[model samples]
Target: MSTQKRTVLITGCSDGGLGAALARAFKDAGFFVYATARNPAKMQSLAALDIETLQLDVQSQESVNSCAARIKQLDVLVNNAGGQFVMPLSDVDIEAAKKIYDLNVWSQIRVIQAFLPLLIASKGMIVNNTSIASVAAVPFQSIYNSSKAAIASVSETLRLEVEPFGVKVIDLRTGVVKSNLINNLKETQHPKLPDGSIYEFAKDTVEKALRQDGFEGQGLDQAVWAKAIVGDLMKKNPPALIWRGESAWLSRIASILPHGLLDGTLKKLVGLDIVEKAIKEGRH
Candidate 1:
């Protein structure tokens, strides 16, 4: 009878976020869980649960190396640390967008490359937490949307490349899940339409639409979401792509639909129809 508990390490486990929720779920599932965040102070609640907490800045090679060097065994690696940015694509802040890509896309690759030796040694799994946004083309989220799309592509290719090493890769095409993502954004920067921007006419509508879901709590409960995700990952033969959380079905549907079919509806939902009207009226 083997009594060795499986070990799992998750990044971005700050309190009130999806990573924290996932760390709890994995802990409850009886795995040895390492919950990490750049600021370890934010993970106090997780630490109180006796879950091992570490500092991990996914964007820093030094941080990634330091974190990996401490872990002696790992069965699952969840690339869950990420951020969101919302703004009109036309006037997108190139530097801000680049930061988003660095955190959301390249950082995942960096972490994977740093930890591949550990994953390969265990014949473990790599779960990349992507979003339905990757396929949905939601309004005013071009930077976020594109970054997610890029990771999805990376996960797809990495799955094949890692399979030969007996490692599994799962692209978690997440839907809306209740977390601190939006609130954190608001607290940090309060995203707004830039001054004198072309979309200024639709500023209130666009910004409201952007924050609506987060404020209204329209997503699935994070604990439930994490439980479902962990269950899938625990399967003897887990899926290559796992879609869970609120509105995940919509992402699946959108993926198969003809391109541009949802553009009009998506636009109207985010008040882009009003923007279009203003543009046609030459009111700017």
Candidate 2:
């Protein structure tokens, strides 16, 4: 009987985020957990729990290669390190948008490519932490939403490509879970509609909408969400797509419904209707 413990490596395990919570849950589930963040110091909580924490800047090829080289064995790889950008497409900083894409979309591919050898050897699973926003578009988040959508698409294609190696690919279409993603965005980016921009007339409304995306106090607890996610991932034949979090079901529903039907509701939810009215009235 093989008594080897299953090993899992998860990225973006900074404190107070989904990655960290997942590390704890995976540990409790009896798997050897490797929790990582761009800055190891941010993983103090996980380190105190005795989980092996590493520094992994997903956007850096050298960092990803170094992190992969350290792990002798891996049964699962959870790509969870990502960033958010909130601004109208017209006024968004191109470089900032590219940075988000690098972190959210390209970085996942980078890590997967770097670690594919280990995954192929174990015939393990790859879980890409995409979001409900991939399907359900929200106002002022064009770049972030599209990046997630691109990853979801990539995960689908990757599933087919990796099947021959006995590796499983899972697209985790996450809904809103309580995390510091938005708070970090607010502190670091403070995205705003530029002066003289088309959406400037709705600056307050846009900014408020950005801040109140149902993630602050309304989303599922990170630990709770992580538990459910890990439970699903640990199944004998884990599902290809798992949607678990607040409003996840709603996003699923929206994905199936006609976009025309959802357009008005989405616009109203984010106060885009008022912005449209103001634009039509030449309020800009």
Predicted model with the maximum lDDT: 2
The 0-to-1 C-alpha lDDT of every candidate, in the order given, reads 0.89, 0.90
TM-score of each: 0.95, 0.95
lDDT of 1 by residue, 169-261 (tens): 999999988887878878776777778887777777777866654354668999999999999999999999899988899879888999888
| Model 1 clashing residue pairs (backbone) | none
lDDT of 2 by residue, 1-284 (tens): 12289999999999989999999999999999999999999999999999999999998999999988888888999999998888878888898889999999999999999989999999999999999989988878899999999999999999999999999999999998888887898888876677788766778888788775555766899989999999999999998999999989999988888767888888998899998999889887
The C-alpha RMSD of each candidate to the native structure, in angstroms, is 2.1, 2.0
TM-score: model 2 vs. ground truth: 0.95
lDDT for position 136 in model 1: 87
lDDT of 1: 0.89
